[model samples]
Every structure is written in C-alpha cells, then in structure tokens.
Target: MSTVFLALQTNEDTRPIIEAILQDNPGAVVDEQPAMVKINADGRLVVRRETIEELIGRDYDLQELQVNMITMSGNLDQTDDEITLFWKS
Candidate 1:
C-alpha cells in the first residue's frame, strides 16, 4: 500500500484536528515541524467530523480545516461526516 498524507498548519485550532486524525487512524505517523503538522498513513487516511467535534467539544464544519491546511496527498473524498484520502490502484 502506498502512503497518503495531510498537512495542516500547527496552531491552537489545529491541535484538535491532529488529535482527531490520530485517534481515527491508528497507523498514522505524525511529523511535527515548527509551524506545521503532517500526518501520514499507509494506503488510507480519514478525518471524521464527529471525532473532531468531540475533541474540540463543539460543532465543527469540515470546511474549517481548509483554513489551516497547507497541503495534502491522495485522492480526496469529502462528505458531511468525513474526509478520506487514498491512492487508487
């Protein structure tokens, strides 16, 4: 399986996003930089709105992530509940 990744700017707002990603993707590896956080997973990565909301203790719109996003790699699929990234065979 190939790797997929999501890069988000590091800040208070993104801390919960990163936590949610890690909670959902047990195999994901995180790379922390000075001002950016990148998460890598083999084959697939998923970000769930529900999990993020729980982490942040409030309602969350997936679109809010765009504000802190820098870059990503994979075939993007987004819905009301989740965002999934994967490489197509």
Candidate 2:
C-alpha cells in the first residue's frame, strides 16, 4: 500500500467536528492547522468532499466548506489500517 496525504482549510472552531469525521473513518487521521485541517486516512487523504455537501444540506456554510486548495496523493490499502497524519497551527 502507498501513503496518501490531504489538506483542508477551515475554521479553528470546527476541529472537533472534523476530528470526529476522521475518527469514524478508521486508519484516518486529522490534523488541525491555523485556518486549515489536514487529513490522512488509510492511503487516501483528502477533505471529505461529500461531507461538505452533506453538511451543506443541514444548512452549514457552503463557502466555509470551499477548500482554498486541496491536495491528494498516493494509493490506499483497502484491507488494513496504515496511515498517519500531522498538523499544527
């Protein structure tokens, strides 16, 4: 399996919600940075694209979910948990 890295831009206050999403997704890690969050899950790292839509349906700020810039790299090992994440504000 290869390693995947992803980054997201968001408010500091939503760290917990972001963390929860990552936690629910095993082998997934969430990193909080100033006005941004980085997520590494399995071998595919990226802000939950669908998550944004889902939240928006609930009346969340769509603009807030808009990523200034998002990057995703590597492949994932579908059968196991093999990923780590690091983030700092």
Candidate 3:
C-alpha cells in the first residue's frame, strides 16, 4: 500500500487537530520533529471537521487546517465536513 502523510506546525492550535486526525485514522503513525508533527498511514488518512470540533469543544472550519499545514502526500479530496488523502491505486 502507498503511504499518505500530513505534516503540520507544532503549536497549541494544532494539538487538537493532531488528536482529531489520530482518532479518525487508525494505524496512523506520528513522527514529531523540532517544530513539526508528521502523521503517516498506509493507503489513506482522513481529517474530519466534526472530530476537531468535538476535541476542541467548538466549531471548526476545515480550511483552518491550512494555517498550520506544512505539507502532505496523496491525492486530496476536501469538503466542508472532511478532508481525505488516499492513493489512487
């Protein structure tokens, strides 16, 4: 399976976002760097707005993720409710 990854700046704002990603994506591996956190999963990864909202106890806009996002891999599909990354094959 192809691996998909999402890297984001490490900060208070992203702490809940990272938690949401882990809750939504099972088997995802997290790698922490100096100022960044990278999560890798085989084949696919997903980020959900509802999950983030639940974690942070407030509404969340999926676009807000762009603020802390550093980079990512895989084909991207985004919607008002969620963002998904996956390999075509």
TM-score of each: 0.98, 0.45, 0.98
lDDT score for candidate 3 against the true structure: 0.97
Highest lDDT model number: 1
Tell me the tens digit of each residue's lDDT in model 1 across 1-89.
Answer: 99999999989999989999999999999999999999999999999999999999999999999999999999999999999999999
Q: Clashing residue pairs, candidate 3?
A: none
Judge candidate 1 against the unseen true structure and give its global Cα lDDT, from 0 to 1: 0.97
Q: How many clashes would you count in candidate 1?
A: 0
Candidate 2 per-residue C-alpha lDDT over 1-89 given as tens digits, one digit per residue, 9 for 90 to 100: 45556566675435544654565566776676777777665544434434544544443433443344355455422212222232321
Candidate 3 lDDT, tens digit per residue, 27-49? Answer: 99999999999999999999999
Order of the predicted models by lDDT, top scorer first: 1, 3, 2
Model 2 score (lDDT): 0.50
Model 3 residue 83 CA deviation in Å: 0.3
TM-score of 2: 0.45
Per TM-score, what order, best first? 1, 3, 2
